[model samples]
Target: MSEVTVTVRGEHETRVAPERATIRLSVRAEGSERSPVVEHAMRLTEPVRDSITARKESGVIVDWTSTRLSVRAERPWNNEGKRLAPIYYASIDLTATFIDASDLSIWVSDVSPWDGVEVGSVSWHLTPETNARLEREVASEAVGVAVARARAYATALGLHDVEPVEIADAGLIAPTASAPPAGMAKFRGMVQESGDMTGASMAYEPDAIVITATVEARFVAR
Candidate 1:
């Protein structure tokens, strides 16, 4: 048989447990007076900040940050449609990364009931080194799949040899290659959170991270 072109797409996916959890929290206070609100937010934030710094030193927390205190004022309307005096709000946002998920749960449970502390969300992700390693492995496997597919096509055509002509990401080998496919290799992190009101307790749930890689290849069969 004469040389013929064969194009195929290969994909690989793997799921892994997350290695890090980053949580966001805000300390907020509101009142008819601006000064007291600001002071109150700052006071509530001190213990939270202390806990994060202590955890960082103990290696339970990898990193943490705090935003400057901010204040906003708004005049709310009552049922009578009368504009009331402006109410002042003060807030500060804080974020912390925990290497251990259990530590995150413990810390959140401790701070959640504070007068002005609010838990926002938790992000679960893999370490950079692990993600890179797994992505490379899956990409190589995808290439192998492309080769096997080309060989199968050659066999069906009564040919015995297949050789790779070109290889690119999921979109690069075809006329439609300009737009990369969504299945292409990417770094992804999952944001998940849950809570239970049982006895005023708290809970956290983080899903597994999934990595997928796709590639396109062109081969000659004869």
Candidate 2:
């Protein structure tokens, strides 16, 4: 007698609003000398950091880092077609991660006034607990779908017993956040109304994070 085997695949997807957010801010400064450019970039970090700390909402975390720093002179042609004195350029980046979305508006309003500092992306995501819970639920649903398909296959083959021989997690899909607003002008205006952060009610809303789970199951019939 020969044994019969069936392989089935199941997929499940779930969407949920994000519960956490990461906001990045950048500072760029340029000058004729390396010292001045670097100094200016470093000086710009104070106000932005101070502003976030001043927020009424608690649990707001701020992290500052230097993404890029370069001090090189670039020669340019003058009206006479002669190379002019070299110009030096320097740039720095700072990022802030906030647990509460409520502080986004105020942070933007306060930091927009700075000359070189600009608001970066605002990524939203579900917390670890919520993500884990969703993963488990979706995994179960996917396996159920696979089991049903396997049983149907066994019945069609005139098999009495159908047992799952192999099962595997196909790796869950990660969630993606919506792109940040186009510019700070509109975002600043949205929060300037009452000088209050637009907690979860900003004019722009992040897209719901989608999570997908898949499972592959192999069944054998006796």
Candidate 3:
């Protein structure tokens, strides 16, 4: 049998400032009929579009797009000749990109009318510039960590010198967002609030995203 070889592993984490923001907004409309539900959904989504446009005009929002549109109908279930009400609902989802910190915060705070509208999720991002800077910082830190670990291992093994032979980056980590599925009733409530231009109590708190990277290194012992 061949001699066994031992490989060590090292990990490091760094918290870098986020340079961009992605805000996900879901607009919904509901009514007794499909046509009216769709109409109301469109009407309610107008303000959300307007809000995004306003932010763009004010140089706060960088980009915006409608990601998804869905319509759902729920028929009343009858048992023992009991009658129930039928429901119809529609929903629209949008994503707005913010490049400025102040604007991002303002948009998050001001994107109200949330009673019916469900704030799906929010994600922080690293802009190209910030990403480049962080890459360099993290790489340096990772190398230091690897070297320290190798040194410790070499000392424990009674080795005098340790030299790196290979270094390969595993990959970079990115932030992602996931929203819970919504039903017709929930969609309709959001649309109604927006269409009626009524204000409701809605509070949202987005989680912070932490990005990480890993590396596989091979070193020779002397």
Whole-model Cα lDDT of every candidate shown, in order: 0.82, 0.63, 0.60
List candidate 1 segments past 4 Å from native: 175-184, 187-190, 194-199
The TM-score leader among the candidates is 1
Q: Once superposed on the true structure, which residue ranges of model 2 sit more than 4 Å away at CA?
A: 1-3, 55-57, 62-72, 79-81, 157-160, 169-202
Q: Which window of ten consecutive residues has the lowest lDDT sum in model 2?
A: 181-190
Taking the tens digit of each residue's C-alpha lDDT, what string does model 2 give over 1-222? Answer: 358878877666667766766666666777777788888876776676566665424556543344655455688899999998777766666566665566665566556667777666676666668866877777787788888989888788887688988877543222124322111111111112222332323433556676666677788877
Model 3 TM-score (2 dp) = 0.67
Rank the candidate models, highest lDDT first. 1, 2, 3
lDDT, residue 52, candidate 2? 60
Q: Which residue ranges in model 3 land beyond 4 Å of their true spot? A: 1-6, 78-86, 100-105, 108-111, 114-116, 152-159, 168-209
Q: What is the lDDT of residue 120 in candidate 1?
A: 84
Per-candidate total of colliding backbone pairs = 1, 0, 4
Model 1: ten consecutive residues of lowest lDDT: 193-202
Predicted model with the maximum lDDT: 1
Candidate 1 residue lDDT tens string, 110-219: 88877788888888877788877887887888788878888998899998888888888877666563444433456566776545322355556667777777888999
Which residue pairs clash in candidate 3? 28-191, 29-188, 30-188, 116-190
